[model samples]
Target: MRSNGGPVIRADIYVRISQDLTGEEQGVARQEESCRQLAADLGMEVRHVWTDNDLSATKKNVVRPDFEAMLASKPEAIICWHTDRLIRVTKDLEKVIELGVNVHAVMAGHLDLSTPAGRAVARTVTAWATYEGEQKAERQKLANQQAAQQGRPYTAGIRPFGYGDDHMTLIADEAAAIVEGAQMILAGESLTAVARKWDEAKLQSPRSKVTGAKGWTLRGVKKVLTSPRYAGMSTYYGEVIGEAQWPPILDPEVHYSVLAILNSPERFSGGKRTGRTPGTLLAGIGGCGYDGCTDTVNGRGYRGVPVYGCKDTHTRTPRSIADDRASKATLARLMFPDFLGQILETQNAQEGQSGAQLQSQAKELRERLDGLAMAYAEGAISLSQMTAGSQAIQKKLETIESELVSTAGIPPLDPVKGVAGLIEGWPTLPLPTRRAWVDFCCIVTLNPAKGRHLTSMSVDDHITIEWRDVSD
Candidate 1:
C-alpha cells in the first residue's frame, strides 16, 4: 500500500505448513489466502507468493526454499498468516529482520524490523515458538515410548507390507506372501529369487503401492523376512520391546530361523556379500584340492555345462557331478546311526535355551537398555551409570546372539523324519539347506584326475570327502 500517497508498497506473501498428510496443500492454500487478504487490507501491491508446503520451520536442518527465495526478492513489504509461520527461531527472526521489510501477519499484526524495539519483539515471539516446538517434540517422543511399552503398533509412516493401513489388521494376500517368502528363505531360496517371484505375481510393496511403483527389490524382500513385526513383536529404535497387538503373519520359530540365516556372518560377511546368491552347491564351500593351491572354486560354464573351477585353474569338475558327490556323501553320513546320533547329541548340548526363552531374554535386555537411555535423558541417572548399565546389557545380548547363531545354523531336519525319511526327502531340500548339510557333515574337494578328460572324471577317483568331527 502507498504511504503518504507515495508509490504503492510491493509485498510478497510467504506461507508454510509443517504437515499436509493428504498432499493436497490445503493448509498452505489457506495460509496464502489469509496472507493475500492481509496484504490487500494494508493496500500493498502483491508482487509474489512464496509457499513451503508440508515443511517444518522449527525442525533442525530444515530448509525452506520458497522462504529463502522470498528473502532474496527483498520486497518492500512481507505478509504472512502468522509470525510463527514466517519464523520459528531467533536465527530465522534475525534473517527476516535483516531483510529491512515491513512485515505484516494476519494474526500477529505488524512487525517493524527497522526499529530496535520491534526487532526485540520479533525475537521474543520466535523464542516462545521455538520453546513450544521443542516441548511438542518431547511429548511426542514420550508418547511413542509409552505406545511401544504397551505393545501398540506404530501407525505413522508407510503401512507395513503384511498389515493393513492401521498396522494392526492383517492384509490376507500380503500376509500370505510374507509367510511364503519367509518359508522360501528358510528353505534356501535366495532373496533375489523371492523378490522376482513377488514382482512376477504383481504383489506390490507398501512403498510401491504409495508411489505407484511396481516391483520389489532384493533388499525389500530381505526386510520383510527379517522384520520382527511379522512374528507379533513390537519394537522401538530397532529393539524388540514386547508382543504386538496384531496377529503374527509368521510363527516365531520361522521368524527367528529367517533372522538367523539372513544375519549369518558366513552368509553376509558384514553385508559385503548381500547380493551374491550362490547358484551351485559347493561353489563357495568347497576348496581346491590340488597341492599348493588353497583358493575356493566358483561356478562357471564349461563346454555348455556348468562346472566348478578353481581360481588358479588347479582343478575343474562338472557342477552336476560335484554336487551329486557332495549330496550322496552328506546323506550317507546322516544315515549312519552313530554319526547321526553324535550330531543330534552335539546340537542338543549346544542349545542351552529354547528359541522362545532366548527371545524373551533378548526382549528383556533391550527393554533394560531403553530404560537406561531414558533415565539418562531425564537426568535421573548419571552418564557413567547409564553407560555401565548399557554395556553390561550389551554384553549379555552379544552372548545370546552368539548362541542364537550357533543354534540357527543347525540343520532344519524333522526329528520325526528318521534317517530313512531324510534320504527320501534329500533331493527336495532347499539348495541352501543341502549346502549347509554338506558343510556340516563333510568337506568335498575336487582333486585333479590325471590324464582324464573332464567328462571321464569319477567321484571315486577324483572327489575327496573328509568328514568333520561332530563331537568337536
Candidate 2:
C-alpha cells in the first residue's frame, strides 16, 4: 500500500574540499547538514554521507572515490545544497547526468543535464573555475619575481638537511647542526658517529620535534655536503637566487673543501687497513720504474714480510727473480739496520711544492689559455693549428698536474722514531701515509745476484722487487 505522502527515493550525499578549506573548521560539516535538511524537505530517504577533505575541487568531473562508489551503488538520486555544489567541475556533473541520476540542489532548479542547455551551463562553470585558478598562480609567480629582484628574503620549504621556506633563508638550529656535522666528518668522525653526536647533543631536526626520525647516515652526510644552502646560496627550480636572508652555516670555502674530500674515493673508500703496515699506499699505483714492466704487490714483503715487487716476474719477464731463500734475504738486507741511516737521510732530503704550488701551476695553464687567445687575435696561428696545439698542451699539462698533485710529497717514515724513542711508530701513522711511501720510494730488485738462477727448479720460482719514489 502506498503511503499518504507518496514514494521517496534514496539520496546519496557527497562532499569535497581542497587544502584551502582546511582553514574552514565547519565547512564540510555545514555542507553535509544542509544537504541532509534539503533531502528531508524533498521527502527523500537519506542514505550515506561520503566526503573527501583536503582535495582540489576545481577539476571538471573529478572522479572522487566516494562519489564514484555512490554512483556504482545505484542510489535513486543525489541531493546537494546547490547546483555548483553538485558539480564544481563539468565532467563530474555530466557523468552523474549521463548515469541518469536525478541531481537536485535545494536552492538551484532541477537539472536534467541530459539536455544541451544544462550541459552548457556545467561546462561554462568548469572553464571559469580553471581560468581563475591559473590566473591566481600567475599573479603569485609575478609577485615572487618582484620580491627576489628587490633582494628580499624568500622562502619555500624546510628540507631534512636544508633551510628556507620562501627564499634564501635557513632555520638556525638545522643549519648549525649540519655545519658542525660536516666539520666532525672532516675531523675523522664516521658519518654514523656524527649522527650520534647530534642526538647526544640534544639537537632536533628542523621539524621542531625530534622523536620520530633516525639520525644521520653516510647517505645523509652526502646530501648535506651537496646542498648549496649551507654555503649561503639558494636555488629554486634551478634558478639561482643570490644573497639569501639566512646566515650560511658553513663558509662556502670550507663547505667546498669537505665536498672534495667526500667525493674523493682515495679519502673515503679505503675502508680500514690491517696488519703491521696498515696501508697499501701503492695499492693502486703500478711499478713502472723498469722498462716495459707493470707490477704491484700486497706491499707484502719477502716471504711473510711486506715488500713491493715486480708482478711481471711471472707474467711479463718470466723467471726474473729466482730462489725464495735468496729473495727473502735480499729484502731483509734492503731494510737492514744500516738502511736506518739512509732512511733518515731520505727523509731529510725530501722536498716538493705545496698545494699552493700545484694551484699556481693550474693558474699557469689558464694563462696559457689566454696566450692562445691572444695568438689567435694576432693571426700568428691557424685555427686548426691553434685547436690541435691547445688540446695537446692541455692533455699533457693535466697529466703532469695530476702526477704532481698525487705525488706531492711525504717525508719517509722517521727511522729515529722507530727504534730510539718508543715502539714501531709506523703503526701510529695512517695506512695511506705508509702506502704512499712504498709507492713513491726507490725501486727494489730481486734480480739474480748476477742475473742467473741457481737451477731449473729455481727458474719457475724466481722472485722480484719493485721501486717506489718520493718527490715533487
Candidate 3:
C-alpha cells in the first residue's frame, strides 16, 4: 500500500531485548517475529531488520550501532516491537522527529511525524518510559541502602578477588594470595611489582562484569589492595558507611599501610610535587647526605640559589655547614646519559621474560610430570610419592601457563620506541603525567658532604641515584 502522493512505503524492523544473559537470540527473535508480523499486517514491505540485544533503552550514552545505522538507511518508517523500545527518552524522540521518519510500534500503533498531534502523543509515551526507568533506579538505590544498613553484603558488581560466588565466603587459595599480596605491599614492594608477580604466577584476575576482560593490571591491583572491603567495611558512594558481613583478607594495620602509600601526596603529585620545594629537580627523592647530619634534607633556595639542606639546619638562625653547591653538583653527577635508557631496558626485560621464558618453564615442568607418571607405572616410585610429586609439578605448571592464553593477542612494545615517544611528547604532556614518569623511573637520595669540608664536596660525594621500575 502506498501513502498519499508516494510509492509503496518501505519500513525497517527494530527489536531490542534489555538483556540476553546467555548471549542468545531467544528474546530478540520473538520480538522480531512479532514486529515482522505487524509489518505484514500493515502492508508495509520490510527493507531491513535491526536489533540491539542485551542493551537497555534507558542507559545513558549507550551506543546502539545497528539502530543508528538503520536510521541512516532512511526507510520510510520504523516498525518496533514497542514504543518504549523505539525511544525511551525525550532526546531520542526528538531525534526521530528531527529525522522526519514516521514510527509504527507493534503494541502502540502508528506515530505520524507529519503532524503536531502525533508528535505530542509520541513524546508523551517516551516521557512515561523515562519516568518508569527513573523510578526503577531510585527503588534499586533504596534497596541497596537498606542492604548496607542491615550489614548484608552488597551482592553486585564483579566479585572481589578473594571472595567466592556467594560474595561472603572466602576461596581458600585466592584468599591466601590476597593476604600474601598485602604483606608484600607492606614490606616496601610497589604495586607495579606486586601486579607483575601476580601476572608471572598466572593468577586469574577478576573478570570484568561489563567488558568480560580477564588479566592482572597495575590499576586493578591498586583497587583490590586499597578497597575498604578487605578491611571488613561496607562503602556506599565511596564512604565507609558500615561494617560488611564478609571476613577481611588483610590485617587492619597492613590494609591501612597500603592505603597510606597509595594515597600519599608524593604519589599523587598533581600539577607539582607537594611536600617538596618547587623548582627543585629531586623534590620527591631529595634527602640529607651529610655523614653525621642524620637529618632529612629538602630542596630549598638559599640567597636566590637552589640547594638541598637539612630541614632543621637550613631553617637555623645562623645556618651551619649545609652545602647548596655540593647538592647541585651531586644531582648533575647522577644524571648519567644511559640512566633512563637503563631503566627502560630493565622494564622491557621484566615484561619480556614473562612471556616465552615462563612458557618454556611450563613445558619443561609438564614433561617432568609425565615422566614421573611413567616411573610410577614402572615401579620406580611409590604411589604416595608419585601423587605428591605430581601435585607439586602440576601446580607449578598451572601457575606458569595460566596467563598464556589471555596474553596471546598482546604485542610487546619496544623500550627504545617508548623512550623516544616520551621525549617527543614531553613538552606537551600534562604535568602529572611527567611527574609520574619521574617517580617511576628513579629514586634520588642526597647526603650531606662529610669528612672533607662540607663546602668542598663534589657531586659524587653527595648524591646517589637508584633506578627503579615502580609507577607509584
Candidate 4:
C-alpha cells in the first residue's frame, strides 16, 4: 500500500514497563493485550511487537534496542499501550513525539495521540502519576522515620547481620556472636580474618542461603561490623534515630565500638578470601571437660566427627573415669528447676500490684496489651513484638472477686501485686488465694548426657532444662 503515493507500511507496537510490571502482577501482559486490541480496532496492520519488562525507563538515552530498531526501520506508525508506558519522564516522551511515534492508552477511554486532546490527556495522566509516586515515597519516609524513633529496624532490604529489622537490635544468638566478634576484632583481628573464621565455622547468614545461587556471601560480615542495627537504633533515609523496636544485638559498648571501627582508618578493612580457611563458632567456647586437663581441646566431632572431649584425656590416660560424669552433674544441678515448686513460689510472690488491687489497674494494662496484640496481628509489629506479645501477659482477670487463690493460701497473682511479691507473702494473704493454685510450668532443657562440665557445657543452651527464670 502507499500513503500519499509515497509508501505505506504496517504499524509496529512497542510495550515497556520499568518496574512493578513483571511477575509481580499482570501489568506486562495487560499492556501488550491492550495494545494489540487497540491496533486491531484502528485497522492498522500489526507489523511487529517488542516488550521491555523491568527495564528502567530512565536508563541511558538511546539504549533501548526496540526503540532503536523501530526508529531505524521507520514503520508507518509506532503504537504503544499508553504514553507513560512509552516514555516515563518528560524528556523521554518529548523525544518520542518528535520522532512521530503515535501513542494510545487502554484506560481513560480515548487518551490518544492523533490530536491535541489526546496529548492533553497524556500530560494530565503523567502529572497525576508523578504526584502519586511522590506521595507514596513521602509516606514511606515518614513511616520509616517513626520506626527509627521507636528503636525499630527500618531498612526494607536484607538485615545487616547481627541486627533485626526494627533497626539496630540484636537477638540472643546474634548478640552472643557479636560479643565474641567485637572482642576479636578489637583484639586486632582483620575483618577478613574474622570473615574467614565465620565461614569455616558454618556461621551462616540468616537472610541468605548456605549454598547455590542464593548462598551467603562475605558481604554479611561487613554488614555486621558497620550496621548500627546491632546497637538498638535505626536510620530513616540515612538519618539515625533512637528507640529501636528490635532487641539489640550486642552490648551498647560493643555496638558503638563497631560503629567507631567502621569510621576509623584502622577498621578491620580487608576481605581476605584467598589462602585462609574461615572461622568456626566453637573456637573460643570449647576446652577440656575437666579443669585439671586444659591442654587438649574437647574436639567438636568424634570418630573423625565433631565432638567435645576431655583435653587431657590423650595425655593423662590414667585420670578418673568419673570426672566427665561429675562435670556434667555439676552443670545440670546448677541449671535444673523444680518446675512446680518454682512456679508456686513465683505465683505467690507479690512482686508489684497486690491481688486485692488487681482489678483497679487491669483495665489500663489490658488496653495497652490489646493495642500491642493488634499491631502484631496486622504485621505492623516486628518479629520481636510478635514474639513478645504472644508470650507476654501471663495472666489477666476482670474482677478479683475478693481473691485469686494461690498454692495453699499463697497470695493471688494479681493485676495489682507483683507475682513475686504475692508468692513471698502468701502465708498472710486471704485463704481464697489458695484457689488460684495452678500446675502449669515451662520445661527447662538440660544435657544429662554430658553433665555440667565447665569445659564442655555451652552457655545458656546446656542449662535451659526445667530452669525457671521468670516466675510471674
Candidate 5:
C-alpha cells in the first residue's frame, strides 16, 4: 500500500461526538468510516480504531479512554475526520503534539507534529474550536433560562415519573401513585417504606428503564415527591420560576407540605420521632406528662403487658387503653359537624398568609440570595458579610416553609354519608394513617398516678388527652 515509504506507517483512527441523542453512536460511526478512508488515501496501515462516543472533548475533566490508549500505543500517525473531533482545546492539542507523530484530518488536511509551523497551526485550530464550544454553551444556557421563565417543560433529561414522554401529558396510573405516595409521606410513612411499597407494586423509576435498575431507591422516591415539576411548576437553578404548562400531579399545597416536612431541620437534627412508621399506634405521638419532663412515650412491654412508657421511666400506661381512648376521641371530633365546620372556618380565615403568599415570600428571598451572590462575585461585599446575610434570609425562608406545612391540615377523609363509614373503618386503617389522625386531633400524655403504684393505676387516672384547638 505504501507509494513513497519503504515501511508503511501505522495509524490509529480516533472518533468522538459530544452528544448522541439517539444513543445510536451514528455520528462516531460516520467519523470512523471517514477516518478509515483517509488512512487508505494517505498510504497508512490502520492498526487500531478508538472511539469516545457521546463524550465532549471541550470539558477539561472528561477522560477519553480510547484517546489515551491511542496515544500510549505510539502509532506512527493519527487519523481523524476533523481537527475538532480529535481535539477541542489547546491542552489536548499539546498532549497530541508531545507524541511527535503526524496527524491527518480528513477535513483539515495534514498536521506534521514534528515541525514548529504545524504545531502552531494545531494550537490555533484548537483555540478556535474551544471558542466555538464556549459560544455554543452560552447560547444553550440562555435558551434554557428563557424556557424556564416561560414555564415551558424541559425536554432534555429523562422523562419525569408521573408524566408521559413529552413531560406534559400525565399518565393516570403513575400520577395516582405519586398522589398516594405524597399523602402517605404526609401521614408519617417513612421514605424507605414508601419506596418498598412502590417496588413491591412493580413501579419503575425513570432510571430503571435506561439502566435496568430493578427497583426504586429511597433517594429516587424522595426526588419524585419533592420535585416542583410534579406540582406544575418550572424551576431554574433549583428555584421555582413559574407555573408549568403541564398539569399538576399534586396540589400546590400538598407539594409545599411535602417539601417543608422533608426539608425540616428538626427531622434531621435529633427529631427521631418524625417521619418514621410507628411499630405501635401510640409510640411516637404520646409523651410523658410528669412535671418537668419532656420526653416521648414509647410502646414496650411492662411486666409482660404492652404499655406506653416514658423514655426516662417517669410514667407508663396500658397501650391498649390509651390507644382506644385516643382513637375514640379523634373519631368523635371527626363525626361532630360543628367541629368539622370550625376547622374549615379556621382554615379559610388563615388564607391571608396561605401557601401562595409563602411561595411569593420564598421567591423574593431566593432573588435576594441571587443578588447577594452576584454582589460577592463583583467584590461589592466580603465573604463574611455574604454568609451572614444569606444565613438570615435562609432562616426566614425555613420559617415560612414550616408554616406552609402546618397550614396543610389533616389529610382528606373518604366521602361517606354522615362520616360514619370512616369511623367504622378506623380499626382497619393503616397504623401510620391512624397515628396521623390522632396527632391531628389531640395530644396524649401519660402521667404518674396520684398515690398508687404505676402498675395498679387505672389508665383513665394516668393518661391525659388534650384535644388540639381548631386553630392548631
Candidate 6:
C-alpha cells in the first residue's frame, strides 16, 4: 500500500489493556480491528502487530514485550488502538522520536513525527494519558481502602483455605476443619501431625491463583490455625485492625491461646542443639523435663559422668543411660533390625506429603506477604490492611521457615548404619544435627523417682522415653 509518496509507509500496530475494574476486556480486539481498518484506509502497509494483555502502562516497570520489539525493529510509523495504548510515559515517547517513527491512533488520529509541532502534539497527548492513568490509579487505591475498611473482599487473588470463592463467605467444612486444627495445635499436637490428619481426611489446601499448589502442608495448617481472620478479625500487617464481615471459626480466646503456643520461646529459640561443638551431641536436644520447662534438654558432665539435664534447673540424668534408653526405644518402635530400610521407606512414603508440602506452602505464603507489601507501597491496599495482613502472614512464614531450618539438620535415622553412618553421624555429628535428631527421635521426660532424691533417682524409672512414631 502507498500514498502520494515514492515509497510505501509501513506501520506497526500496538495494543494494550489493563485488567478492567469491572472484570471485562472492554473491546480491546475491536480497537485492534479498527486500527487495522485505519491503516488500510491510509494506504499504509501493516508491518507487525504488538500487544500486551493485562498490563498497565502506568506501572513503571511493566514490560511491554511487543512494544520494545517494535521499537527495535524501527518501523516507519506506529499505529495503536489509542494514544494511551502506545504509551503513557515520556521515556517511551522519546524512544519513538529517537527511532524517527511517526505514530497514529485510531481514536486520536495522525501524528507527524518529522516536525516540532507534531512532536509537541505527541508529548501533549502522552502527558494527558499519563495523567489519566495516574488519576485512575488513585481512584483504585481509594476503592481498596474503602473495601478494607468495610471488611469486604478487595484483592482478586487466591482464596484463603477456609474462605469460599468470593473470599468473604466461609466454606463450612473447611472452616470447621480450620477450627478443629487450631484446637489440635493448642491441644499439643505437632503441626505436622495436624497436617497429616488433614491430608488423611482429604481436606483441600489453600488454592493459589499464582503458585497453583493444592497439597496440604504443615505450614498451611499453621497459617489457618494462627490467622486472626479465622477468628473474624481483620488484620493489616499482623496487627488486628477491625472485625471482619466473615463469621469467626474460632473464639477469640481460643485463637489467642493458639497464638501463645505457636509463639512460645521454646518453639523458636535455637536451643543447645543449635551451636554445639562437634562432640557435644545432646547439648541442644536435651530438654529440662521438669514441671516448668519442656524446652530442649541440655547435656553436661556432672561429677565427671556424662549427664543430661535441664539447663535452666537442677534436674539432671546420666547422659549415657538417657542416650541408650532413647536409642533402644527408637529402635524398638521407629527403626528396628532394618533401621536404614525402615527409615528410608518411611521417608519415601512421605514424599510430597508433609515436609516438602510444608516447605513449599511456607515459601508461597511468604511471597503472598511480599505481594501485600508491594500492593501497599503502590497504594493499591490500605495502610492498615497491608500492615495487619502482612504481619499475620509474616509471623506464620517466620514460624514455618524457622521450623524448616531447624529440621534441616536432622536426617532420617538409621541405627544399623552405625555411629558414623546414622543421621547426625551418631554422637560425633554437629551440635545442631545431633539436637535435631534427638528432638525427632524421642520425647524425653525426666523427674526424680517418686520417693528418691533428685541426685539418687534410678535411671530406669526416673526418665521416660517416648519414641517418635512417624506413620504418615
lDDT score, candidate 4? 0.51
Which 10-residue window in model 3 sums to the lowest lDDT?
Answer: 314-323
Q: After superposition, how far is residue 22 of candidate 3 from its true place, in Å?
A: 6.0
Q: Model 3: clashing residue pairs?
A: 288-447, 289-447, 289-448, 290-447, 290-448, 330-459
Query: Relative to the true structure, how large is the alpha-carbon lDDT of every model?
Result: 0.79, 0.54, 0.66, 0.51, 0.79, 0.68
- The candidate with the higher lDDT, 2 or 5, is 5
Cα deviation at 363, candidate 4, in Å, is 48
Candidates 2 and 6, the one with greater TM-score = 6
Poorest 10 consecutive residues of model 2 by lDDT? 314-323
TM-score-superior candidate, 3 or 5: 5
Model 4 Cα lDDT, one tens digit per residue, 136-242: 77898788777667765546654555655533555556566666777777687766666666666566675553122243344566567656556665655443455
TM-score of 2: 0.44
In model 1, which runs have C-alpha deviations exceeding 4 angstroms?
1-3, 208-214, 269-472
Model 6's alpha-carbon lDDT is 0.68
Candidate 4 Cα outliers beyond 4 Å, as residue runs: 1-82, 108-111, 155-183, 197-220, 267-472
> TM-scores of the models, in the given order?
0.58, 0.44, 0.53, 0.43, 0.58, 0.49
The clash count of every prediction, one per candidate, is 2, 25, 6, 67, 0, 20
lDDT string, candidate 3, 1-472, tens digits: 4546566768899889776655667888998999889888877899999999988878888988887887777778899988888788888788789778789888888899868998888888888889999999999999998887666777765567889767899988777877778888768787777877776776776664445666676678888887778888886655556778888888766776667566543344422334333443344444555455555444566666556666664221112222333233333323557654564455445446545566678678878988999999999999999999999887655444433422331212122244456555654544444444444454545654444554566555555555653332
Ranking of candidates on lDDT, top first? 5, 1, 6, 3, 2, 4
Query: After aligning candidate 6 to the native by TM-score, how far in Å is the CA of 450 from where it should be?
Result: 62
Query: Measured by TM-score, how close is model 5 to the native structure?
Result: 0.58
Question: For model 1, what is the error of residue 63's alpha carbon versus the real structure, in angstroms, after optimal superposition?
Answer: 2.3
